[model samples]
Target: MAADHTPLTRRQALAALTGAVLMPLADPAAGSVRHERHFLFGSPVDVMLRHAPESPGDAALASVMRGLQHIHAQWNAWKPGELGRINQAFREGRSARVTPALLATIRSAARLERASAGLFNPGIGGAVRAWGFHDDVMRDGARPAAATLAAWRDAAPSLAQIEMRGDRVASRNPRLQLDFGAYAKGVAIDRALDEFAARGQGDALVNLGGNLGAMGATGWQIGIRDPFGEGLLASLATQGREAVVTSGSYERFRMLDGERCTHILDPSIAAPAQGLVSVTVLHRSAALADAAATALLVAGPLRWREVAQRMGVTQVLAVGPDGRGIASGALAARLQFASRDWRGRIATV
Candidate 1:
């Protein structure tokens, strides 16, 4: 799920063949693991639960899937959902009422945007659309003109411009179109994990694409994919109640003017981010890990450590455009390289 970005069958097969395996229960007669895969947010959502035969695992899984659907209906920017309506309100210069959950997400994004010093902005939806990334299928041909990119860069839209009063929200900057593609999946996974915990099914894993969260007595083993190749770079075991997320240029990219353009847009340049090939962050909160991965990727190699420190993330792994990779000492300690030939260095930070 971290890379290859291939179809479901191949990706799942590769994960299984590699080291990203779920631990087997001690007593097969006592319990079984229920696994299901669904499509949401233009990506696959995989749910795994280990439960006793009489436990309501199926029911819990259904509830969690329904919750994810609700989230997609509310937050999907391309679809005619709550997010669409809010974008319409922004265009009309009017305030729109939002659900409590949506409000909380927006506020949390604002906080993270500030914490990352605008490196992880969600208010560049207009720029994202201009780059032809708003549609399920990317628009082909030439890239957006330099003038268009300059206009967006000059506008400098940010999530901080969004104003919220009770349930109503408005934006001071008309250019501030909200896009939570980088943040929503993690939040949804967190919610699903919470639901599993609430149902006394603490032994569960929710993986939305490559961003995932897990909880159990003995945690899950996750493989970090090589950014430049199909093989996995390393494997690590997660602790209880932890999320692992990776942001990379290897997936969700389009070829424009013979150049591969990624989906992650840097607000400062008003274009797809460059320099770093991928970044992975491990944290207790999936949302934070997701956002931090993007921020650190945009930060690139030189500034990623500073940004990670500012964001209070101790575990991080980043790979540059070249084959060079760096991991925070905290993360390096837990990583088990799949091969000794891996080109990774550890930093104390």
Candidate 2:
């Protein structure tokens, strides 16, 4: 429901403080692969190129990072950005003109909402904030009061409450806030891919906090994280230009008064999702894969197939709370798991 508003963990915070960029594979046999790194979009943003980091080709890498920063600036809800201004206007019962990118995002979000049967809602910001996810990491690691949760549910801020006309956007529900966390990373990834291609840097892998997009004939090798525990659950090699996006309930959670509540809230319940631990989607567009993976994650195991079909994504892997993974046939063909603990738990759907 929200966009890339990630909470800082000890590991990530330390890495950012130390300026450590993760480049898992830097094989010289492939080419002169240079990595350009930055901490953007609440996560590590990296670009691996087949050119020198200080060369002219690195402009694309720099451009991609700057573009992500620009999008983060506009789409960030917690900051005093363009989106916040629009939300403030809505709070005062007024309509306001938004940038073209924001408008396009709203329009596409509306389509995704219908496509996911309302499972992927950008209008759940109130409930998202109610659980104290409005900041970098949860400042108050306590669950929201029962009445506060009820109020947000009763209000039900959804796409139905939003109104988009020409360049202007507004909402009828004052309590409804927009969080693009579910969609913005993918959009930024897609934009970065396009930007890289435009800059003549075709062989590159851009990862924005594990929502990755690869643009090159060489393809890319990606590792899927275990949701219930640490380390990798599996690995997959991309087929041509492909992107891999994973949404896990365990990635970000708040320790709420002796309990752990995840960040992926079910729009139906206005609470954190349950049952499944992670969902990963493979597609050409990282944006679609990002949102689709989230929808499938929220849908859990029982209904993930239907949601995946609705999202037009055929290659997906949904991991259960027990560490077992069920993925599409296409995804199974590309996945390679070396974990001995994962053999009996994986099956092709």
Candidate 3:
């Protein structure tokens, strides 16, 4: 999920969490350790691996990053890519041919909409762009006007209306634009983990922006971003084969008409969702956690728990508009709340 806030890289967040940089891994030899950084999907993709220098870990990481680039090329919203072509086809009321991977992602997103009970909607790409989130070219003072936002918000039916058959996808709705930024990181991480495993990777941490996955390790620490202030609100341990992701309204935003506007648009109202400070979700599937976090962010205080349940998500922590820390029973059991009591008592969901 996109936010208007300046997102912290995993390294930055971990530094604040542990009073040092990143997770305390089973420190490999300096020559054997590899931490590669790259610009993928307009966000930082970080991979830390514990493999000997002479091994193929370097090449494996390179291949994984390249795979992510290829995926971004297909579905990225901003540039002239396969997703752009698909949007054009939708505009023309024609079917667009998609790779098996793209088709699968589209179908998966559609299922997410259903599974989340319409809480997750990729069809808001048009409204998101209108709100000036489609491009990171950063038009500082530019944002959609009330009228434009309304028009785009009402322009299309929900994602449930899109029709897909085999590898062909079609959308007759004029405002039906798809932006997979919310889950792309997690999907990429899953892909990377699959690649690493095939190449006999050792313990590793795959972090894309704030969406992270850890494998071949135990009790790795993660810090939940305190959306309201500095430092983290809590630290938690990750189970093997787990992914953690957080979404906040301020993560990606610009000042519109002298007002702070974020990328987390509400599909129902075609406006920015309010009242939620942040939402963090953890699950085994990075992709699912990514999308579910966004949905729960939009769900905010009242409906977040219900959405989490619908998504089969038992681990969640949410900051409400009132600045209270709310978490699911499962998450609360595992979380160690930071001593910053100013953030308030933990409220169970």
Candidate 4:
């Protein structure tokens, strides 16, 4: 089914512009938490970190930010860097040692792959490239040929074929090239939060393009983007000592053949997910929530409740393309849906 690619409303656009211009000036000395928004993982990222009462916390946060940036700088396939190393590994047809940090991430990726039954494979780089999502190759209404799709489909590595032995990871199939875009940003946030916490930061919230993680006793409020209405889908109001993450097909897309295509390519089908438009999850860790969002997207509505139950996720919310949504048992009980008088919206469940 074809979907519509909606641009941000004037208000939303203004908010984004305001955030971009004002975020860099946010310093810890302000005695309040600051929200910093940026583009990463080929998607938008927003981070909220509490200011440290002392100069040391400020310096620590700044250093943590720099480290996060470096991780993305080296590993972002959209640009160029350590991705070439992965490419090299593929060429060599052998396992490669990744940085301790990256190894932790890849190990998490492997675990998610096993959990999702291969639906969230990282070895879809060939398919992603062929689809022209890596570069601006889809410009001017470009679409890959059926033959190219066939080649990628044939070459893409199965999750089962990937081998991860701590700091080293390899693919049984030489054609398999890994792309962790689906979950890397969340992992980055997790790492950043960990680093900040280790430095004695009181409370911190890391939003790597949308995926978010928070540490400490202070709970954060998050506004869920509405799919068919004005403003937030709903706000999660709680002060949990955990992290929250959300993802949606509503962001990042290119039009082709009179069809709107999103950037969330399902490794199982080598195409973007169908039916669902947005999915959000709250959990103890950003990595799990982020990976779960993708897996739920691929699973669609059919297996959502079951998977969420199996994974022991705290909560989940999903909006279908038809403007209908369902919330998990946990979330339904926790969040207060928007009122119609104010937003002309209603929530069932």
Pick by lDDT: which candidate is best?
A: 1
lDDT of each: 0.80, 0.77, 0.73, 0.65
Candidate 2, residue 97: how far the Cα is off, in Å? 1.6
Question: After aligning candidate 2 to the native by TM-score, how far in Å is the CA of 155 from where it should be?
Answer: 1.9
Give the clash count for model 1: 0
lDDT of 1 at 108: 92
Question: Which parts of model 1 have CA positions greater than 4 angstroms off?
Answer: 1-13, 17-31, 343-349
How far off is residue 151 in model 1, in Å? 1.8
Ranking by TM-score: 1, 2, 3, 4
lDDT of 1 by residue, 95-158 (tens): 9999999999999999999999999998989999889999888655789999988888888998
How many angstroms is residue 298 displaced in model 4 relative to the true structure, after the best TM-score fit?
Answer: 1.3
lDDT of 3 by residue, 32-52 (tens): 457787767776667777653
- Candidate that beats the other on TM-score, 2 or 3, i.e. the better one: 2
The alpha-carbon lDDT assigned to residue 231 of candidate 2 equals 51
TM-score on alpha carbons, each prediction: 0.90, 0.90, 0.87, 0.83
lDDT of 4 by residue, 1-349 (tens): 1112233334433342322111112233434775555665555566556657657666776777787778778777556677668666766887777787776676677777877776677777777776667774456476668787776677757656767787777776876776777777667877787787778785777666556676656555545556554455444543555556666776667786768887778776677778787778888777788888877777787877666665567588777887777776666555544433212222333
